[model samples]
Target: MKTARIIDILPQCYSLFLPPFFKNPIPIESAATCRNCAMLEKPDSHVHAPKFFSAKTKCCTHHPDIPNYLVGALMNSDDPEHETGRQRMLNRIAGKTSISPLGVFRPKKFTLLSRNSNLEYFGRSEFLRCPFHDDEGFCTVMPYWDAVCSTWFCKHDAGEEGWRFWRTLRTYLENLQKILSRYVLLKMDFKPSISGLSIDVSAPLTLQELDDLPPPEPIYRKSWGAWAGNETEFYKQAYTLIRQLSQDEFARIEGIEQKLLLRELEQAYGLLTTTPLPERLKKNPELNIEKISESSYLLSGYSPFDPLKISKRLYDCLDFFDGSLTNQQVIRLCHDQHEVGLPEEILKKLHRFRILIAVGETK
Candidate 1:
C-alpha cells in the first residue's frame, strides 16, 4: 500500500510540529508520476486529459514561497547531489532579487500579473516558471520544497475526497509556514518591519511597474533589519531555532484558527482514507456521460478532472441500482439478467468516486 507519514507531508523544517507517532506511514493518494506526465496526451491514457501542459513544464510554473527554515535546510543539506540546488540558492541570495529575510518570493510584477491574469497562463508561461525547476524538467530543490509544492497534485485517486483533503492540508501548512517563519525571525531578535515593503496592488500596474524590477535597496534592507547582509546565516539560525521547538512550544505558538484547520484536515484525511459502502445504492442523478466509443462511456461529475471509463454493458446495469433494492440484490439482478458480475472493489470505487450514491444522501 502506498502511503506517506505526517512527517513526509511537509518539508523537514516543519517536522518539529509533527508528533513522533505520526512517522508511521498510512494509506494516501499515490504520488504523481511526473516522468510519465499524466497531463500530457498519450495514446493509451485512459483518463480524458487535456493536452494543455508541455513535457518541459508539466505544472512546474508557479513560484513557491520557500520559508526561511526551508531555505536553510536546502543550503545545509549534506547530500552531494544537492550542490546544484544549493548553488542556485546562493545565486538568488547574491543577486538580491527576490531574497528577503522571510525567504525567497516572487517579484511584485509577477505577483501582480498572476493576480490579474486568467489561469490559462498558469502551466504554459515561462515568465512564471519556478527557478528551482532545472532545464531537464526536474525540481532541483525537491527535498526542501515549500508547502505549496508539497501539497499540489494534478489528479487524485480518491477523486473529490482526495482533493478536499489535500486542499485543506495545503491551507493549514501555508498558514503554519507564515506563522512559523515570523516566529523564527522574532526568536532571532530580528524585528522585521511589517510595513517596510508594502505594494499598492489595488490599481492596475503601469508599464514601468511591470518591468519586474527588484525592490529598492533601502526598503529591502529595512525589511531584513539586522539580518540584511547575513541572510544565509540568519536562515541557518532560523532552521536551528525551529528544529529545537517541542510539540508543546509549537502548540502554544499556533492560533485557534490553525487548531480548527488542523481538525478539519484530520477529518478530511479520514474521509479520504476510509471507503464505506452504503447498504443501498443508486446511480448519481448528476453524472455526465459521454460516449467515447460504442462499447465505452466516460463517466464524470464527481470531479471533472478525474473521469471513470465504464463499459457499455456496465453502463446499462446502472439502472439496476435505483434505490429500490439492496446492493447485494442489485448485484444478483445484474448477474442473473445480464451476465455481469459487479465486484465489491469496483462498486466501492464507483461509490467512493460518487458515480454511485447512497439511497438518501445528497451529493
Candidate 2:
C-alpha cells in the first residue's frame, strides 16, 4: 500500500491554517464516485437490495456550517469556479438569511425538523437539502466545504474502518473550526454574544419559526456588536487573521479537548490505513444475506448504502469460522474440507466490514 499523508485526506482550505509540512496527495475515494454517483439505483438489482439515493439529492441532504474564514474565502475568491459559491454567499449576506458574523448556519426550522424526525430526513428529504447544492447536482462550495461535508462519504473504501476515521476527523475539524472562528472574533476586538448569536432550539419552534426567517434585527445586531453592518468585511478580515496564524499560535489556542481529539484523529487514521486482521474470526450473526445469483450472494450488514458481494462457495466457508480456530487454521480447514482457498485481502475486508468479527469482539 502507498503511504498516505495528512495533507492527502484534508480539505484544501486547511492549507491556509495548517503548517507547510503537510503537503502530499493521498488516495482519493474512488468508491464514492461523486461525478457519476455510485449511489444511484441499478435496474436489475434484487428487490431486497438497499435502495439508492435520488439522482437530484445523492446525499447532499444536510446543511453545513461554513465557518467565517471559509465564508470569507469563498466571498473573496477570484477563481471562476468559485463564482457560483461566491454569489450564493453574497445572497445569504444580503438577505441576512442564517448569516452571522461567525458563520452561516443551517436554518432553525430545518434543524428542528431534522432533530424531531431523528434524522430520518437524511438523504431522503428535499426540505433539508443543502443551500449550496446546485441544480446541476454539484456542490458550489466544493474545495471550501465545511468539516462535515468534507469528511463524510456515503461509501468508504476501507468500509467501517474508513467510516470511523472520517467521523473522528470530522469531529476534530468541527471543534477546530469553532475555536478558530471565535478566536478571530476576539482578535478583532469584537466580543461575541453567544446567547444572541446561537439559535435557541431547546424549546420547539413556533409556526412562524418554521419558515426561513432570519434572526430579529436587535438580536442580530447584538451578536455582531461593533461589526454589525460590515459583516462581509469582518469575514474577510477574519480570513486574513486566521491565514496568518503560525502553528505555535494555533496550538496555543487549542485546549485539552481539542488536543485529545487531534490525537484520537491521528490514531483513527493509522487504524484505517493499517487495519490488522484478527487472530481468530467468526461470522457476524446480524448480516442480512440475499442470493443474487446461483453462484453469488449479497451481504448487507457493513452499511445500509453499500453491500458486499461474496461467492456461494465463500459463503459456505463462513461456518468454519466459529472462533475456536486461528486464521491460518480456518484457512487450512476450508482448503482441506471444501477445497476453497480464502484470500488474505478478502478476509481483511470481511473483518473491516464486521462481516467477520474477532473471536472475543462484539459489534
Candidate 3:
C-alpha cells in the first residue's frame, strides 16, 4: 500500500473533531428606543425596533407572539430558574405584572392558553400594548421573551452584522422547534414525523390531534410540575445546541459579509437618480462636516457611514442642495457653475446615511 501524506489525513479528521462553535462576533443592540424617539411625539407615531417587540419599544405594524413549543418550555418548573420564568410568564398572562401600553398585550384583555389543552394555547388581545409592559415603559418579562421577540432587529440598527446575526438566529429557532416538537411526540410514543409545529395559534391542532389519530391517553405528563421538568431540560439543551448551530452557520457565511454589504452599497448607488432627492435636504444642524484630507471628510454623530471621501465637485453639489434645491437642480447647477459632471451616486450614499432628510417640501 502507498504511504499516506499528512495533508490527505487532515481533511477526514477535521470533521470528526470540529470545535464547538461559540461566541457570536456580531454585536446585537438590545436597548429599547420608544421613550426618547422624536417620532413618538406624533400622535399617530409608531415605535420601530426592527423586529423584536417588548414593553419599551413596540412595532405596531407587526404584533409578534410566542411560539407553542417555547410556551410549553416556559410552563416547566423543574428548577428555580425555570420556576421563576414560569411564574413571570403567568404573571404577564394574568395581567398582574406591571407592563407598558405600547404593543398588543393589554392588562385584563390578554388571555392564556388553557392549562388542560395541548401545545395550543397563546395570548390574544385587541389593544396595541403588550400585556407584560409596565407603567414605567419596560417589559416585565424581557428575560423570558419569545424567540422571535428576542432576535428581531431594525434594518438601520442591524446593518450587515445585524442581518447576519438574525439569519443565524432564525436557523437556530427552526432547528430548535424541530427538536422540541419531536421530544414532545416521542414522550407519548408517537412518531415524530406525524406532527408539525404550528406557527399560528389561531389555527392550532386540537388536543385530540396532538394525542394522535387514535386518541390515546396523553403520553407527555400534563401536570404543571411534570411539564415544567420536561420543558426545563428541553430549554437547557435547546440553548446549548442553538449556540453551536449558530456558530457553525456563521462560520459558513462569514466570508460573504463584506461582499454582500458592498452589493447593498451598489444597489443604493443605483437608486440615486430614480428616487426623488429630499427637497428639504440639508446638513444635520447639530453635526459639522470637517475635511479630514483632500478626499476624505468627517461628520460627527454619523455612524456606519462617516468620514466620507468626497471629490470637490461632490462637495459643491452638497452645498447647493441647501434645502432649497432638488437633486436635479444641484446637478444642473454644478455643471453650469463649475463645469463638473457631479455624480448622483455619492449623493445617494449620503442620503442613506442620514446626512440628508426631507424636512419639508422645497419651494
Candidate 4:
C-alpha cells in the first residue's frame, strides 16, 4: 500500500519566493495541488529553469484524472520538438510504468466520484509529478491549463480576481474539450464522462483496447452561478484580467477570444440573413415566447445554450415583422434608424427563428 506524502512545509518557503503579482497566498491548511507551490511558481530570471519530470507534485496526490483535452493539446502543440513531451504524457496516462528519471513523487491511486455514478479511476501510474512541473517547484506551462487544472486554485471561492478569472475561462476550456470528445467518441468508440473518459483501471488498458469499449450513458448536467455566464461575461473578465496582469501572454489569449466571439456572431448572422425572403417566411408556431422579466423575453426557438435574450435591443425586430415585409426591407428599416450595424444583428436574430421567415415555408 502507498501513502500520500503531501509536502506542507516547502510551500511556505516557496510562497515567499513567488513574484509580487501573486497577491493571494493559499492558506496551508486549505491549499490543494492546484494551489501548491509547484503550480504557483514560474521560472525566475536568475535561476536556470529545470527540465520536465514525472515526480508527484502536491496536486496529483489527491486528484483522479488529468484531463485528456490538456493531454491532447500538449501532444498536438505547435512546437514540433514536443514529441518527447507528448510521449511522456501518453505514457503517464496509459499506466505504463511507475519509475521516471526525474524521481517524481508518486501518489497513491485515488477514485473520483463521477457525476455519472460510475467508479472512474485513474491508472495507478498517473499520480506522479506533472510533466509540466520542473525540479524547482515551478509550472512550465501557465496559461493553457484545461478547465479542471486551471481551477485547481485553492482560493477560487474566496472571491479574488485571479481565482475568478480562471473560473470565467472554465466553460470556454470545457467547450474545447467537448469538441475533442466528439471527435474521439466518433472515431475511437470511447465514452466521455463529465471529467474525462470512463475507463476501467484494474489493469492498464491499451489505447486500442480502450477504444473497443462501449459508450457511457449521459448524465444530468450540474449548474452553478458563475460571474462569467456566457461569451459576453467571459470577455468582461478576460479584459479585466488582461489589464490587471499587464502580461504580454494574456494579450494573445484575449486576441484569440475576441476573434472567436466575432466569428460566432458572424456565423449566426450569416445563417439567418442568407435565406431567400420568399422561400420560408412565418413565425415558428412551436416557438413559446415567454416574458421572463420586464427587460428580458425568453423565446423558445434556438439557443446555443439556453433561451436567448431577444429584448436586450431597444426595439424587438421580431415583433415588427408580420410576414408583410421582405427580410431585406425589414433590415433596411432597422438600419436606416440605427445608422449602425447593430440593427442588422437584431434583424439577423429575428430571422433566426421563424419570427420573420423566408415566406414559402410554413412553420
Instruction: Give each model's clash number.
Output: 0, 0, 17, 14
lDDT for each candidate structure: 0.77, 0.78, 0.40, 0.37
Question: Distance (Å) between predicted and true CA of 285, model 2?
Answer: 1.6
Tens digit of lDDT per residue, candidate 3, span 41-124? 344422221112333434322233443334433453255545544665654434312111111121221222233334212221
Q: Write the per-residue lDDT of candidate 1 for residues 143-261, one digit (tens) a residue.
A: 68777787777767777677787788789888887887888867877664543233456767654446555457776677777677888998898888888888999889888888888
By lDDT, who's the top model here?
A: 2
Estimated TM-score per prediction?
0.87, 0.92, 0.37, 0.28
lDDT score of residue 56 within candidate 4: 43
Which residue pairs in model 1 clash with each other?
Answer: none
Residue-level lDDT for 328 in candidate 1: 97
Please identify which of the two predictions, 1 or 4, would achieve the higher lDDT against the true structure: 1
TM-score of 4: 0.28
Give the candidate order by descending TM-score: 2, 1, 3, 4
Give the candidates in order of lDDT, highest first. 2, 1, 3, 4
Pitting candidate 2 against candidate 4, the one with the higher TM-score is 2
Q: How accurate is candidate 1 locally (lDDT)?
A: 0.77
Q: Lowest-lDDT window of 10 residues in candidate 3?
A: 98-107
lDDT of 4 by residue, 1-363 (tens): 122112122112112222232342333323233433432335541122222222344343233233332344454465644555555555553442221111111222322222223321211134334565544544543333344554444322122222333444344445533443333333333333322232345555444334432123122111111311231222223323222333343333334553464355344323322433352244555555666566656554432112334553433545435567665665565567644343444544455443445555454
Candidate 1 lDDT at 69 equals 85
